[model samples]
Target: MDLLHHFPHARQRPLRELLAEKQTWVNQDKKGFLRYRALLNELRHIRATWLDLNSDVVHIGRPSDLSPADRVHLQAALCSLKPWRKGPFSVFGIEIDAEWRSERKWNRLIPELPDLSGKIVADIGSNNGYYMFRMAFHHPTLVLGFEPYVHHYYTFNLLNSFAGLSNLQNTLLGIEHLSLFPESFDVIFCMGILYHRPSPIESLQALHVALKPGGSIIVESQAIPGEEPVALFPEHTYAKVPGTWFVPTATCLQHWMQRAGFHNIRCFCAHEMSSEEQRQTPWMEFESFQDFIDKDNPGLTIEGYPAPRRVFFAANKN
Candidate 1:
């Protein structure tokens, strides 16, 4: 829970002050997330001496190179955290086929990103630090990921330790808590989480406050395809995922960004999600995107809302 000690010398004081302000909440979270204490202890047994950082696969180590006993131990420790939703990692010898083909998302987002060399970055709603690992390839000064879920937070820390990365840090915090710092980050990535918030505009405002002047934000969100600036407010659920509030078009998102004090907004790419991009895999044995869409008409969700399409936006704070 003492996080600032992990930071570099220059960042320690500011981060330490922030943590001191939130010490009580952090203590409660430490207790809440440490429920998987046994599995976490077992994870300490994994050791990876080899690494490939720049590649799309992000190979940790070869499984065949490990003894049979060690390989089994590695798999057991990883599988203990089931329903893995964000990766397709090759750790040691086992291939963890996660629910989302995150590599594809990485490829799509990378081309749109500015050069991140030596920049401080924040990834909001970072599920298991998939993108944070990818962002590390750019030699960013630091990559901080905020994930509220306890399981995903632990999973990211476990994977980061396996990767032996010093530049990336994952914390068990929510995007709403970005208010703790002002003008702290150079780039903020808020992906696939806008529709979940009842007040997406306020969330964007918080992101603006967190960024340095002229800092850019990369927003990836679920959208209902259209040229008009409109948003869908589902009565209850969208795509069978509860808590979904709004699915806006690309134009609507641009407008929202402008209203939230961002300028020079650009809709880089908007694509419909394919079934291959998300499906139940060995690591995640649960319902996936396909299950939420209507089988009779692939263009609509079970609730008869528009099918899932995603849009990426790049905007700057002025």
Candidate 2:
């Protein structure tokens, strides 16, 4: 796909150069690229006949589209891309029960979501384009997803190839690339990404710059419980997940936004996560939420920190 065609405004901004750099990095390790290509080759021939992105499962095609042998091939192709983290998608009647029941999180934010008609939106850390596909139902002019992980980038590409959402696009990029898109988006969703950054304030500032004036940013992150304007800098990891730098209280998160110059900040939802929300499934057969928390004390992580609780906040660029 010619990604540059979608961003005419960004054509002169080194976007192409950046994409080239990313592609070089992806191919730098020839062995890894070949391994990834081998898995992707499995789904290159399969395509969905029809799709309904608005549904809970993000239905795609029908079971009858495939013969018995084709069905087996399709399932095997999907399994090769295991650890599906953010969807409950149904592709040609084959259900993918991913680790996270992402619809639950989407439901919590949908009520507060602004009308997306004719808007340009970005979804950071958009694993497998689950949220991007859902956002498409609102008829956004564009829904660009940034997922640097090779597995997710290809997973989205395969699904999009089948579903053929012209307005939905995935890029092998991450939050660090947002600077190239200054004032480019109408709405930005930065979910499950903040805490991973070592500098939350700087990350928010980058997000601030990426938005057009008055554009909204919806943020969702793992948070701790407290009214104090403080954050928990984990000694090593949180909930057994590494790269988690700081888990802030809801108020602290709001304060971070204020410092970053966002206006009309609202911390709307705060809910404790549970195994029911994110657990192991056939598609994602890895240790999950249940294993991350203490066996005896569910209120704390196995690392002895407060258990995982997620908070949603929305604010607009001033």
TM-score for each predicted model, relative to the true structure: 0.90, 0.95
lDDT of each: 0.82, 0.88
Ten-residue stretch with the least lDDT total in model 1: 1-10
Give the runs in model 2 whose Cα sits over 4 Å from its true position. 5-13, 27-29
Residue 217 Cα positional deviation in candidate 2, in Å, after optimal superposition? 1.1
TM-score of candidate 1 on Cα atoms, chains taken together: 0.90
Say which candidate scores most in TM-score. 2
TM-score of model number 2: 0.95
> Looking at candidate 2, what is the lDDT of residue 67?
79
lDDT of 2 by residue, 23-125 (tens): 8887775876776666557656666788888777888778987878878977887888898998999989989999999999999998889779999899999
Q: Candidate 1 on 96-139: residue-level lDDT in tens? A: 88889888888887777977899988999998887898888889
